[model samples]
Target: MRVRQMAAPLGAIVEDLDVRAVDASTAKELNRLFCQHHVLVFPKQQLTPDEQIAFAEHWGELIPFPYGSLPGYPNIIELRNRGKARDVNQHWHSDMTYDPTPPKLTMLYALEAPAIGGETAFANQILAYQELSAGMKKLVGSLVATHSAKDLARLYGQDPDQASEAEHPVVRTHDESGEKALYVCRAFTRQFQDWSRQESKALLDYLYEHCVRPEYQARHQWQAGDLVMWDNRCLLHYAVHDHGEDPRLIHRLQVQGTSPV
Candidate 1:
């Protein structure tokens, strides 16, 4: 398989490879590419839930998707929508951060896609941290941010307090590469762990804005039979919600991860 960088921030597209039958050496190289590139896009491919799970296992242990899954497979989350105004994926964030151990990687396989605008965007958080002023970096290194499903529930008109919450380092280190990345996001991250909400607002907001700089992003427009996945450890993604009444179906799965240090 040949790997090519997508654009400015960080992403790679792997061409001329069949996803279903990756060999041991190929799997090792793909995993290495995943760490180096962050997002790996394998276009023009078809896969069943079983096939997707089989391919995913080569990278890491599969984790349960909290909401629900495809009928037979407990490891896969089915994303089928005609579009809605109050979309959960509208904001930029990592997945399931409220959990003590959030997902290490997330994969999405497109079965049906919109013809127009329903692009998923990703940001390189490592770049975000590296570009910050030295003082800002030092301050963030000393802090931990609150990430909660409660904040997400509020956005979807649900009982906010009933949702889960956890605290993770504002700057997390990559397990494989030993690189630091800004971890706070607008969707799940609430505020600094020990500070009052009011006191944490300004700083968190600045980080929320800073982390999504255009230079650190890459947009993927979907197509049927496209498989895309990202490293949740060092990147954040936003699912765009502009495609109205268009049928979009994507199968999702994530791998278990340790708590960010």
Candidate 2:
């Protein structure tokens, strides 16, 4: 299999690799590329729900998204266009960060994509942390932030009072690559631990903006046969909702991860 870099900071387009038939050695090599590049896009592939789940298990244990899952496939969920007002993922975030151990990685297999828009954008948090000033790095290294799923819970018709919430370090060490990454995101992270929202707003907003600078970002335009997987541990992603009423259907899976250090 050949892998080509897709962007400056984080993505790789993998060619000559079929997800439905990855051998042991190829799986190992794919894991290495995943750690190094943080995102992999496989084009012109077809995988059923079962096939996708089997492929995802090569990395680690599969995790069921708390919100919802596809019928007859507990580990896979469907992502489709609701409406512009109901777009829950328009902001940048790591998936399910409010869980004690968020997903290590997420995979999406597109079955339908709009003609004009509906691209997913990613930011390299590892690069974002690396480019911070020394003093800023030191400051963030000592901080922890609270992440909440209240908005998601409400949107999914669940009780907001029981939504998941957890605290994680502002800067977390990637378990596989051992690189530091800025972990705060605009969607879920509420405030630094022990700091009120009023007090944390300034610094948190600054960090939220800093983590997604264009120099550290890449965009992927979706296609019907594209399978895109990304490391949630070291990156933040935004789902662009510019497709309006156009149909976009994707099946998603996630692998369970260790708690961020």
Candidate of highest lDDT? 2
- Cα lDDT for residue 208, model 1? 86
**Candidate 1 lDDT, 126-226, residue by residue in tens:** 99999999999999999998888976677657787788888899999999889999998888888897899988999988888999999999999999999
All candidates: TM-score? 0.96, 0.98
List per-candidate RMSD values in Å: 1.5, 1.0
Q: Candidate 2, after superposition: displacement of residue 195 in Å?
A: 1.5
lDDT (CA) per prediction? 0.89, 0.92
Query: Across residues 19-73, which tens digit of lDDT does each residue of candidate 2 receive?
Result: 9899788889899999999999999888999988888889999999998899999
Q: How many residue pairs clash in all the candidates, one count each?
A: 0, 0
**C-alpha positional error of residue 43 in candidate 2 after TM-score superposition, expressed in Å:** 0.7
Model 2 collision count:
0
Global CA lDDT computed for model 1: 0.89
